[model samples]
Target: MAQMTGKQYKESLKKVKPVIYYMGEKVDDITKHPAFIPHINAAALTYDMALAPEFEELCSAKSHLTGERINRFTHIHQNHDDLIKKVKMLRAIGQQTGSCFQRCVGFDGMNATYSVSYDIDKKFGTGYHERFKNFVKMIQTKDLMPSGAMTDPKGDRSLSPSQQKDPDMYVHVIEKRKDGIVVSGAKAHITGAVNSHGHLVMPTTAMREGDKDYAVCFYVPIDAPGVMHIFGRQSNDTRKCDCSMDQGNCEYGCVGGEALIVFDKVFVPNEYVFMCGEWEYAGELVERFATFHRQNYGGCKGGLADVLVGAVYSLALAQGTAKASHVREKLAEMIHLAETIYCCSIACSCQGFAQPAGSFQADPLMANVTKLNVTRNVYEIARLAHDITGGLLATMPSEFDLHDPTVGKWVDKYMKGSSSVPAETRMRLIRLIDAMTCGTALAESMHGAGSPQAQMIMIERRGSLERKKKLAEKLAKIGDQPVLIC
Candidate 1:
């Protein structure tokens, strides 16, 4: 196949079986498991969508190195327009999935590394960039998903990687050999780890020269020796099993259905190692990835917020509250919130700049602003959703109850908000709202890219508060003029 059609991609995942655990049980097959099925389905859509004639331009990109048309996820941002298209494409995927598709982390990580490794070679005379290119080519050719692994166990948040109570708190080099390195540690809260074909692993945070052991980065198959994936729990996740009305987004579980991936004595071939001992550049790599990922949150999640807004508005109509002044005001607030998030992301894309190697980087300040706004807007939108949805969302009987022989009539009668709207329809919408607002959706918003604190730190560090202050001072006739030393 010229492009590894979506069917081929899914078929390829069947070749390597990852050791996945959920709720103390080893999953025999992840693609069939309820917890993972939705994630897989959502990801499959990303691949399938790429082949559609209408979306080809946005979903695919010409490989800069190979001149092949690869999935846009494999593309390195070539210019400001490419950056904008990346954001737009993410929004489109978000609208389709209505949850984190769980692919963008690796997408951003790979692109960031593509550019960073090139720069690294310029200074260090290393061949990392070419190695990365080869890896990308393989992934694109095989149509494999490479989940990006960054965060470590980080046993003690206050301590540096080198000083942690356990040296493995942050993934580090345990054994170095002539052939390759054996790494031991774990990556937590990994999105789509179980469904991915491989991992693009990197240090969770910046490192000092003394922390060289922790500065390693590499890629390996998901089912590589000593790799295991364990699923995390989410609120009301069991609804998927209960077959109840609360099975929010029944086709997909909560945000990305994250898992913790353990790497115990995993040997990474030397060819796969990209950043071994490059401690100083670790920070640059991380910052760049975070910037791109943070921008992504605004695009994808913001588009999801659009769906939420529409869902709530439609819900208001079903409840006969659509014409109410308060309901209209709530809907407007949601629009305002969604647009605020979207605007920040778009603004960042339009202002992208070129890196040393000519790859485009989003405007740091705008990207930070976009993610920061999303962090807050997500909460505000969720709260407004709850307000518009009313209290019955929590107390509603199970879908099974609504379908039960004896209670079905009573449940349907009382649950009716509008005379013409069917009870089942209303319940389905409410369940969807609950799924998006109450469970993983909210936390994903708070976290998906990074946590609220993480966004605020970026806002403080990269945002133009100084520039704003200078503008204010200059406008109000305060502070020294722009002056330079002789």
Candidate 2:
């Protein structure tokens, strides 16, 4: 097998039988469902773009394991350049889709597991590294999209997994069999879960010896018996199925189509299990995954911000306000914020270093900073966009009203911003702004990869404050005997 084309990718889903439910109805074919199609379209581009000559350099990579050409999404970061290209690739796709393509999660998961498995093997003489490499090869060869399942539905935030009132609140290995193990629980807000080929399940947080059962990582086909996905609702998701103009970015939808994936004692074969009871190493895997994942916010969100900035500018033009001093100033601010995000991603990538397993990772401190900035900067960019676009962005007439014979003329007349620009054109741009700057899109920016607090935690641990203090003391000559200051 080789990298699949977009058409081939869509056709591949027919063979996948993940149990999916949306709006109280069983979804038989996610590729065909209107609600899921936009997201599927967004993901399929990851395949199509890799083959395009214009994007091949960024979207495709030579597999380190097999020396075969593979989608970069499936390739392990073999060097610092590979890490940098990952950010470029994400931005390229984000620019095109103007929404979440939903593949980076698994890409980060593979890289995190690759290095961690090797360390685990070195420490415990386990074969996890080899198993993980084989799994990576399969994904690369077949061009599969696997959701990285990490966040568990913790019933009580204060309690550790082992102390939870319900053991299944966190995904755990309930029974270890000779062949493999049975995992039971749910992964919430799992991006692309309903549309992916399978899931790379990992522990959500660090674990102690008592939490051994919860320190599990493995792969399971989405359609495995006892597995089911409940598709999540977005702010204006219904528009995806009902209206065109109302569904801003109708071709790609807004945000990754997320879902809640449940494992009811799903059985996994030994060949697919990457980690079993390695509780001590769970934190390493989590941090590695978080770093790699956080490193993406600037690339993806920056690209999306590019589109939002364009939308606001277009709206301003349609309203004949493009030359307004305030609008121009706001546009400039949005551009600065978007590029600042891109700079952070690039900086982290440039600072990437090799791991013990011969794989590369982004600079942890900078990567966390990059994501934290995204949590705030993306919102600020959206706020500026709204300031320039006006309240019509939120109060625009529905596409239905524009099409109605009775009210159509009235909407066309009253909605006209500039007589030179079609009311339809203005409406489209406003909708795009509305879709990209509002509810679901903004929330994903704030919390995706990890929340702002999660990034702060990493930043605090990796910030090297003590080292900075030492440097400051040496510079000031105040370490052992303080020097008199002028």
Candidate 3:
């Protein structure tokens, strides 16, 4: 049980051969597919770092379960330190990739499942806790990249899973057999499905008595019999196929490689199923999973902000505006916003306490607040980056023009920002900025773990307004008496 190197990880994907479709055609080889290569490269960097001696401590951790040096992505958080390290690891990866490396969902999912399963066993006297430990042990031992398939395709926004006109709108158990249960329906916006070795499936929302069949949690291999993965497209994603210069962060592309994972009567054996029909705990499971996932935005996006801030500075220098007081001010603002997020993430992790399970959990209030800020701050960071970079971001000459035989010289001659720097350098940084801010990165920021409204709801629930009101009363000298108006 050793960690896979980047090359080993890439080779491993070649063997998966999940049934994936992109652009109306079956993706035969994702490793070489232009649409998927950037994503693969981005995820591989996670493995690449684990193998680097300099990054080994940050990227690799000794597994509490096996005592082997496992990629931090697979190791469960054991203490407050583990949680802090998780955020730092995410930021580090974000710094390198500048896009979604698409591994955190499973990491969060594993911890959530670990804690919730123990709670389930405590109440129902079930063996799901043991089952989950065995399940995750396999994941860590193999160092697998697993997607947490949580969001379901609710046919109507207003309808719940069981209330939908289409019963298959949300993934649910369709039948029960002696050997296993069969599930159907789909999970949407699944990050890295095509590249993942497996998926950790969980209920999308809280469930009631009527939604028993929908209240299920399990893990399934990506290539399972009836699973079909339809790859998603990003804004200007096609640019990767045609031009490298225009595809800013050309090596990593933009955002998570999301997909619609349709599970049509996929079978899950008893050993693989963690929760079958315990409807009451569905909400608890969802909350646990989301809290950890939300806590993650600070780290990943903060790292990405690092890259964006650097891009802004580089472009300003190339444009001879590096010393402009306003430009420097805006650059500092971007860093401030990004680091503020990191601070919240670290705070939540430091405040984390051990769950009933051995693993620790992030503070939900701070985690939600962190995500809430991320929804706004990412947009603001992008806005400041856009303002400083100028309109050339929107109207840059194509890489083709720069490489053309006749117009190449003319394009270079005119596109040059500062004589001290090359036109190509300016164009490259701007494209990177455009790719990150204008495309999937910002949208993912808004909606990755949950939408802005989702965080607001959690914040309102956890804000403890009553305590604030009591403090306000004490400040107003009301004491224990009720104040009345005439």
Candidate 4:
């Protein structure tokens, strides 16, 4: 079989019994759990789009190893076209789900691991690349959703892994046997932690020599014994329980519910282990993954921006300000910000580069810049959305109050802007706006790939200040020569 259909994927989830916890209860049916269902629905969209004629080209690709058609999430991007298709596919999914689908992290980890493992083997004569290929092929064959777990629960930002207060704070190899290794520690803010069929884990940061225990990378089934998921809370997430209006994107999962995934003495077989005790290449592996992760923010965030823009515009109509001069101007400003993000996304893809293994990577500088733009652009986009929405975006009454027979008529009369638009319609628009702006939506844009600070670091590292200085010097012939800038 090629890529699995949405129905097939949902059915597959029933076979694997993963230990998942959300709110205060143990979740047995992940596919249908109230807190987890919307995320599953969002992920199912990844499967559904593969069968759509218009999106198939962008959403699926032939696997580089097995030559079978697989979701693009499982395929290794091979050229500039692949990169462009990737960005577009992310945009399409964002439009379809209008929220974080919580699957791309694994897609990125697979690609990043594929490249890094290949490089590691070349330098150390290991068979990691071949081992990784076999694992990826299995994932593609099953059409599995594997969440990539990278970030650790770093207790102290100032200390290194070896110097931490707790030795297990960062995932580390606690036992090494002839067969494999046992890793004990936890990953924090693990996106889609409990919902994934499998988990692909790697180092969150570069490692030094003594930190070899912390440099391990491998894949394991989410249902692996000793693995546990503790779901995180988001702003207004209990609305999920209420199942009410104004919760925003209530039908779709909230900001891809992240959880603290603890790997307590988890064991991996020798074949499944890709990176182990490779200190020197740790930096290389991290930078490679980070660059691609940063590249993704542009596509996904730009798509979310579109939804926000659409929400604001829709709210304007419901409020009867669609024709007002200020409304028109604020809407225009929103459009400009939206397109700016989209342009950055497209530019990064267009300027993509090929790897030694034939996979494509976006220009590091451009990709980081794209995400940096996402940080500021999305906030401003929300500001404009809020501006057009007026006070009601913040002060809108509860649907319950409006639905009460005693107050329903009063709400219909006073809580509306235009006689032509129904009060309920205005309420729906407000709910949509509230969903896209507060809580998960904003956080996704700010820290989806990495935080704004992470992008700033990338900018500083990849930016060419000397070259910029040279351009100015050349105009005045003030310097002897321009050193090539990194």
Candidate 5:
């Protein structure tokens, strides 16, 4: 087995020197930092599960390249079953952790790179395919976590990368030396960048003829010189430091710990550069990566929905409303939405076929459909959770008040919902619901995989509306008249 234990994973982070800033201060050790530890714990769960007998099959896979048992997070999909298993693994992790495990983006990135690099080689006779295969093999053998960098900070939404007033608005190759290239720009909303072993950086969008500099892709160590990360702030992030009860899902925190990673003239050796100035293939790479990433939401969010449902159910019971007709109906609705997303993920996976490079890819249409529904479904699901939990979710008193000598007794008395359930229990459940529904978790659900409109564009392109119109015309007895326009 080429996998590390949770303890080993945490120990490994202490060796890296990633320059990370949080709340205007440099974080020397992310593993011990309160703001990052919950996310780390969530990610560590992925490692811990692989060591268990029951979860071994779901969390570990036989690497195609090395024939060794490797973490599923590092294995490229070898078949449709592998793809299906990926979703199942994500959901299982989600259920257990009740938060983003923060590894799926890297998993998806490797798969996309595996297939797209082969296609790029076929088109332009580049050796990127072989280089990428070696990279994947190294990742699996070492069990490294590679954060996928795709989203860029678009200074002007309407402008192209080349048109941005700031040349570094999109990551680009500033200097191509004999050894390799130096890239300068920043990748935004990068999930788990601080904790990951390194990054698999890819272009954020398609490139035109003049955008050659921006059409670059490569990998870099997180602690590489000139690479820096500014940690993103989450809702109630400060609560992590002071209030235990108020920090709902305290063990796993909120969504994936995201950050802005800046590449300031970071040098990459030739072996690490997968694509450079491949303007034509940029769109293909973006689509492949984005589709695979979108498919991930189904499993992870489904797992999250499971947690939300459980929290809502617990809160309902705490408030003595679990058996009400309307409550039951709303709970059922939440289940329906969650299952629907999971089904889409599975549908896309089951429908997948092998790519040219022998890696399986989900059906683009179904994957986009899965994500599009996620954009809307997660919100409604959270809405029902909030509806069931009631006003206490937002207006609940801090844990300090519950423990205060002056107000503790009265707070406990009035906060108590039922004699059977403890006041503290009721308050805890309410806090959990509040954090999951109203915090970073919900935002990630809305915009994590290229946002709602991006998924819609992919869906529209894949839909083939003209074919549907043709079917409608044929059914309506409208013949194809060639001379009607005269």
Candidate 6:
């Protein structure tokens, strides 16, 4: 089949029957559910954009496996250009959605697995690489959305998965059958979990020898028996059901529509199991995936920041403050921060090099640096936005009040920003700023790829401080002269 259109993607969901719960009730059809439709719409654009003439070069790629045209999300990073295009594609989608489109996780997972499996095969004489290649071909042909499921529900911070009071705290292989394995545990805060076609499950962290069972990795259909999802709630998510204007980014929603996916003794056939009992390579897979995923923040968040900066500027205009020096300065600061993020993403991509398995990955040090900057810069950008827009962003009345028949006249009269701009237009822009800057959106920016500390650890490991010190010593003539007796 050719790449799916947005409409086809929506229809495809109708055939999937994942066991999903939102609030307290079972969602019969996620495609039709109000809570999921916005996220679904956001993901669908990932497909639709690829078919558009202008975006085709960035959003679509020829599959290395079959030479067929496929969505870039399913294509492996075959070269440095492919890695760079991945960043560009993310930014474009982020600008279009102004929210998490939720496909990058799986894309990163595929690439990480592709390279790591080969190394594992070389050392252990395993056939994981060939099996994974087949899996990639299938995904490319079907153009399916697979949630990259990592991040286990760790019961305690100090304990390893093997030492945890409850062994099931992290996903582990409970029973290894002749045909395959049965995994039992849960993955928390999984993006697009409820809406995706299946999950590419992976270990959350590095593992020791005793943690072999927890190092398991595999793919399972969303509707696979014993797999169930409990949809997570965003700060203003319920507003999605009630009002349009109040919901902010009403059409696209926020933060990837995360969910808690439980695998209760879910059986998987051997064909879908990419890694099993491969404890030694767990850290390699984790690091590779983290670096690739980290490289994306600048692209996606920078694009989102672009929308936010524009909205703030529009708000200033509506209130007749566009020419104010302070507001203009704040706007300029926001643009600078956003562009700085884009530069980091591009730099990392351009510095990317090929792995042993012939897939390109972003430079590790730059990618970590890129994500660390995102953690701090995006917040400052949001702060400047709030300063320019004022407290009215949070204090605004509901959309219902704006449209209420009895008090509507009062709202229109008092809320008017300028004599020329309609009060309704100003209110709409306020709501957009409110949704983009607060609650779930802000938190996702801080910890989406990994926490600030996670990036710091990688930076410390890869920083090459000793080498840098030598350069400094040589420049200062300290290396040329023998060390003093002192």
Best by lDDT: 2
Q: How accurate is candidate 3 locally (lDDT)?
A: 0.91
lDDT by residue (tens digit), candidate 6, 26-117: 99888877789889999999999999999999999999889999999999999989988999999999999999999999999999999999
lDDT of 1 at 327: 87
In model 3, where is the ten-residue run with the lowest total lDDT? 477-486
Point out where model 5 deviates above 4 Å. Answer: 480-486
Candidate 1 per-residue lDDT, tens place, 215-314, comes to 9889989899999999998788777666555777876555787899999999999889888888888988888888898888778877788778888988
- For each candidate, the alpha-carbon lDDT, in order, equals 0.84, 0.93, 0.91, 0.83, 0.90, 0.92
How does candidate 6 fare on TM-score?
Answer: 0.98
Instruction: Give the higher-TM-score candidate: 1 or 6.
Output: 6
Which lDDT value does model 2 have at 435?
89
Error of 6 at 29 (Å): 0.9
Q: Candidates 1 and 6: which is better by lDDT?
A: 6
Poorest stretch of ten by lDDT in candidate 6: 477-486
The local lDDT score (0 to 100) that residue 410 gets in candidate 5 is: 89
Tens-digit lDDT track for model 3 on 188-290? 9999888899899999899999999999999999888999999999999889888477998779988889999999989999888988889999999999899
Model 4 score (lDDT): 0.83
Model 6 stretches with alpha carbons more than 4 Å out? 476-486
What TM-score, over all chains together, does every model reach? 0.96, 0.98, 0.97, 0.96, 0.98, 0.98
Off by over 4 Å in 4: 482-486
The number of residue pairs in model 3 that clash at the backbone is 0
> What stretches of model 3 exceed 4 Å from their correct place?
479-486
TM-score of 3: 0.97
RMSD of 5: 2.6
After superposition on all CA atoms, what RMSD does each candidate show versus the true structure?
Answer: 2.0, 2.1, 2.5, 1.8, 2.6, 2.3
Candidate 5 CA-lDDT value? 0.90
